[model samples]
Target: MVAPLSAWPWENLGCFKYLLYGPFLAKVLYSRFHDQEASEYSWCLHILVICALRGLIHQIWSSYSNMLFLKRNFRIIEHGVDFKQIDKEWDWDNFIILQALIASMASYMFPFPANLPFWNTKGFIAVLTLHMAVSEPLYYLMHRYVLHGNSFFTHHHSLHHSSPVPQPFTAGLATFSEHLMLAVIIGIPILGASLMGYGSIITIYSYVLIFDFLRCLGHCNVEVVPYQIFKTIPFLRYLLYTPTYHSLHHTEMGTNFCLFMPLFDAIWKTLNGKSWELHKKIRSNLGKSGRVPDFVFLAHVVDVSAALHAPFVFRSFAALPFSPRFFIIPLWPLTLLALLMMWAWSKTFVYSFYKLTGRLHQTWVVPRFGFQYFLPFAREGINKHIEQAILRADKLGIKVISLAALNKNEALNGGGTLFVDKHPNLNVRVVHGNTLTAAVILNDLPKNVEEVFLTGATSKLGRAIALYLCRKRVRVLMLTLSAERFQKIQKEAPVDCQNYLVQVTKYQAAQNCKTWIVGKWITPREQSWAPPGTHFHQFVVPPIFSFRRDCTYGDLAAMRLPDDVQGLGCCEYTMARGVVHACHAGGVVHLLEGWTHHEVGAIDVDRIDLVWNAALKHGLRPVSSSC
Candidate 1:
């Protein structure tokens, strides 16, 4: 009995036909051509040779155009335009190599059969032309739907999208699956024609090569053909495609789906309706800028030179001796190492260059008469004036505290107090008891103290302190290098303390005797002030005190948390005076509860099984059951 309808004959037909067409065609062709007719075969040979040459020339020209477009129009430094939108590397080297291997196989293993009726020279050419016309619409449909569809886009099509404005070289740069799909789609019509005795497979192959060349040309950046001619004659327009139309496909995306003609897109309403408007605008802008197309020509030269020389340059390097001299001496290794280092250094250099230029290009800041402040980095004579102000302040018994040394690490070290050990006279203390403690400490300062100097104050902390001090009617002098750096603090600094936190340079503070008259002065590092009510809830515990349920050690000794956690916990709770064990447990409960209740300090409690158990058994989890 015949197999069920589910077991279709064409299930494995593709694979079987793929294996048969190549060898069968070659044998038939060999049988038909006599030994004496080898010379007469020159006609066929010349045609094939001419076709191949034309395809190659077209590819080269297209590639040149694309390179020019990139070099001239590409905005590399702009945030939205250039490298940010595209991947750092093309990353299609493997895909290209695989395609080359497949093309090579297709070239060698497949030859047209002369013995077959479908292999007749003129008949084959006619059928091949018809096949191309039919296949064009299919190609458009596949490009519009399957390639652009969300399901397959990322895996199969996103690689093409990597180059938003692609070059000609990128035309064939697709995933292997995409290439195979193209081969199947393209091969089917030609195969069908050959089976029906309408065309030679060789003619179909020639058409495919020419099609690839034109496709690459369509993507080229240079305008090889005039837009007016193509726009005027609909049938003739189908013969010659333009770069502008194809480029819009890559640039705007999902707009121009047709390859050879705009007919498909026009029929489907996928054509970019404003293409002409955009073209006119682009031309007008280019004209206003006095831009010429010479840059495009120059870019082509560069691309050609790079392509031709790159192989030789790479081979020369590869041929070098693998010795210490080649590897380490005479700056080769040093040069490579320098280049590697240069990758990061170049970014820094570019940033610095732009910053310098920006500063140089900026208009001078004219000071408002009575409230005049020196420029932040005026190296001429501003230092002496600043020093004199500081001396005057010191003479008035105001203690100058500097918090320059308080880094993030030191802040963590001092139980998140953010105090540095640089100042000997500044009484440093960690008064806040919780994670939001950064604010609480400043709020609860002694009322008798005329001025409290906080050295390491971020904008948030500075804002918090300024707000608190302004409420208490205390003078809070906040000294920094630049007013711009502390602009946030200046804006948010309480209106009452607007004049109190008088920003001054170190030199200015040192110069003025009146600055010393202020009860106490603090000079935090530039831009360190934090606004009022700012909190750091997610305070990390030292590794020694952290217990990970997922991790286990060979012995208990190997599994201990960091010693700093123990030291801080003991010092903050166990070693403090008037510290009850119940209060200590309560503090832990508050910390844990804060983690759950607040978004700022939320902790992952799923792994805190032991802590959860202890808190529950000892009634330390806090009474708010909703948490």
Candidate 2:
């Protein structure tokens, strides 16, 4: 629930909310352009840099803490963050915006130190002493009494507490009034130092950076601070708070209301008794191995910008269907830098996870992109990554590992056939997930249809779809130039049904066929040959565009996860909420069914209906696509 207080006016702007700094940015740029003295725009530039740095700090902590490879065992809360939490905390950086705006205004109203030196030992000491004396207690008092005890403040502060599993940005997720109070608490020491003629640029930067750093650290949900220090110096526990310490506040609302220091909590006898014990307990388990997921979706990055859609990078962005955002264009440099780094030193990593029916499901990414898969030289490297991932999953005793998108490319690794062939003794099931993919596409076709046009006629999915349709006595116009491959697939069908599969090499052959099954991308000219109202069913990667207005296009094969799925905070590429590509769902079905066979290489045409039925049996529903 939203606080009764009014929200930030620019809340709906989403990414454009940063434009609130336009006036300050313009003033800084204009002042610099006019060749003014350093003091004229330096402070404004400082405020901008500080705010950006604060955001960067939060991003770094978020990335690190969410990295299961790094700190999975150390997680205080094992449950995944859901879409509701993500939507609520979408504007986690609102406090930074508020801080920038207030600081910019205060620069004009108050007489800040001008032409300040880089370092001032006296100023640094003064700020620290003043924070300990004034800021800490005042914040604790307001947070404990007003925020918790009063009705209005309680309503707003509840927003922050809503996120039971605190993330790095969760520290800043609050209402305008709460942030305003916080700004005052944080500002008191800096303003006090300036008034006492002890302020320096270094003091302001150092103090604020530490403040932001500690805030992020406390909310990171991982126990990074060593308990040894606290063990040695018991007094230090009162002076500082750990991630586990603050997490208790969110879970147990009435206790541990101190800002960054536990001293006040102890003073007021409000500290939770479990804070230190829980901190030590979580820290002790940090070195142990993490739990293995029941199912793993081996996925690959699509492109540079889409990398940001990884749940760890941007929770809110990943929750929605992915599309290129103009606002994300500015961050291309950082993503590009990350891309280059991954290209140089990338490995398969756990990208996200969730739970369904008591089973843990994880999505792992092979740091290669879609374009990289097409490169001849990168094929071996990509396969090596996939192979290693399969081996790791096998070692971890994972029940099923599903290959998604290009990860199961026949040309690259024979749809994950290479690994299964070489490691025949492997215990883990390597599933291409194409059986269900074919099922979803073929099932969507009208049963009354007498004929259908097929492209990529000899591909694994195309072969399965054509053979399945042939068994139903549907005349299939298989579009292929290679007669040998077509003949081979035709020979596999029943003798009586074989005549239904006919080879057609040209797009003109499909002009009269209204039901077109596209497994390969076709050009506008080729698409033009289709008759008006032709419904195209596809299982193509980077699904084809709807070039003809007279015809309709279908999305790639996908299925909606069961309603009981938990912690499903991110979408699977362009799929809608709770919907996942059929291949991914295929793996889930495999796990739920406890299927023992390795579902790699060629898809089993006979099992299409069985798998489809099994999916329905387990409550997985096909994602209905119009047109």
Candidate 3:
């Protein structure tokens, strides 16, 4: 457990934690209405603006580092950040809030008047000189002697070093004491410049932002600085540090203790001898391609808000199970505009990834939303994006790709049949993963169930469930409008079991059945026909609401990923931590089982049980029903 002082006070508030700045915001509004002089409280507003700009800089670096497309080839650490690391660093912006508050209080306490000039060349030179002479050595001595040499400070510093693989935000993940010390190291030079009578607004903004920018750059875990320049000048290497240089400090813990410049380390004889060599080695591999994934789960966005839940948007928020926050309501219009842009120009891109049992798995989003698939004009565009993703995966030697959710909707792409039929020679196995979906739904049913009610009985999952249950001598009341479609599915079962697959067109026909298998969205009126205590087992997208309080409803077919899974930092849709929709798991099982055939088109009834058993064999547990 973390010590009370080690954690931020507002950590648990989530997005609403921004309300800590409410007083400053209220001040800005009050000044605007009262037509107050710009000099009176303008610095207060400037402090808030600078704080926001600092946050934006960190967010940009973080998002850039996490993007597989942009940073795949240059990743310093091959493994990704896990949920544990994300949780530990959830309050990364605490220091920013604290700094802003301190600055606000200092404004009134200090004798300096407001409206310092915009630019001060003498101030910039003075601060830059003082930073090198005073700030650099002060921080180096304090960091090496106190932070690492002393055990008390080391305990607080350990929180920053906890994440071995660093992202930009990792720079700010530290105990409150450590951050307070950092604020002092940064404050001395600015204070010295002011005491020398050269301080100005630009000087303050420039110095602090550069300090934060360099801090973020070192923790980005990507080698962006070229080695050739360092080789040519040699002295420049000590003036600026690379990501790999700082990364070595995290791993080794005793060397490279200088804040940003390594000159102090070189002068003190504490510089790691291999820093330049290692930086060159990592830089040499920058242009090479990343590894090919073994499995890919092709998915699409569900709605505007869910789009913000992507790993790149907000790492801390994405680490938790997805649900819209009250704070996100203000950003709704912006997200909607982003969606329209995606609809007009976006293609498939990698969303997130993880490694399971030495095999690489990734989720690739199709750049379309659920509602857009139902729009008739958007069908062709959606299918085109999916095809491009499939062909890209095949070209990269990916073994299997599972179509998730609406990406494989029967009405859109014929459950991925259109792609396979069009390109027969493709090596990558295309999978709808409905075999596991049917298995999860069927296994959730009561074993003693004599009669079961089924909705969307003619759909792919519904047909497989009806046929598989009929083999067990269970009666299936398949509700469908097309008698012809019902007869076609019944003929596929054994002749002796054909009578067990009965057809019914109305919800009233299943009033006596206590088990309801729903493949389509059903209204409360339709759900009313089920007997009390009925459990609705469903495979529908955006799962139906649990309107019957007296009854139970199972979540969409899903399975908990194996315990050994690594680098999975976000939840799949709204699934509990570590759980993924069954279709995504099916892709994993396909790679684990080494099956060569594509599990596309109508789900094979025979493979329903086979897939379920394989998932269990590999430690993927089925999700239980809940009210």
Best by TM-score: 2
lDDT by residue for model 3 over 540-619, one digit each (tens)?
77689899998999888988998899998988878888899988888889999999998888988988888999999999
In candidate 3, the residue pairs with backbone N, CA or C atoms under 3 Å apart (3 or more residues apart, or in different chains) clash, namely none
Ranking by lDDT: 2, 3, 1
Alpha-carbon runs more than 4 Å astray in model 3:
1-40, 108-115, 226-234, 286-289, 337-346, 625-627
RMSD of 2: 2.5
Candidate 1: regions farther than 4 A off: 1-59, 66-133, 200-202, 231-235, 238-240, 277-627
Candidate 2 per-residue C-alpha lDDT over 233-328 given as tens digits, one digit per residue, 9 for 90 to 100 = 999999999999998888888899988999999989999999998898889985455678999999989998899888777777889999999878
Worst 10 residues of 2 by lDDT: 109-118
**Candidates' C-alpha lDDT:** 0.38, 0.89, 0.87
How many backbone clashes does every candidate have?
Answer: 39, 0, 0
Q: Estimate, for each residue in 546-565, the C-alpha lDDT of model 1 and write its tens digit.
A: 12232221110001111112
Candidate 2 local distance difference test against the native: 0.89
How would the candidate models be sorted by TM-score, starting from the highest? 2, 3, 1
| Residue 161, candidate 2: C-alpha displacement in angstroms | 0.8
- Backbone clashes (count) for model 3: 0
Candidates 1 and 2 compared: the better one by lDDT is: 2
Best by lDDT: 2
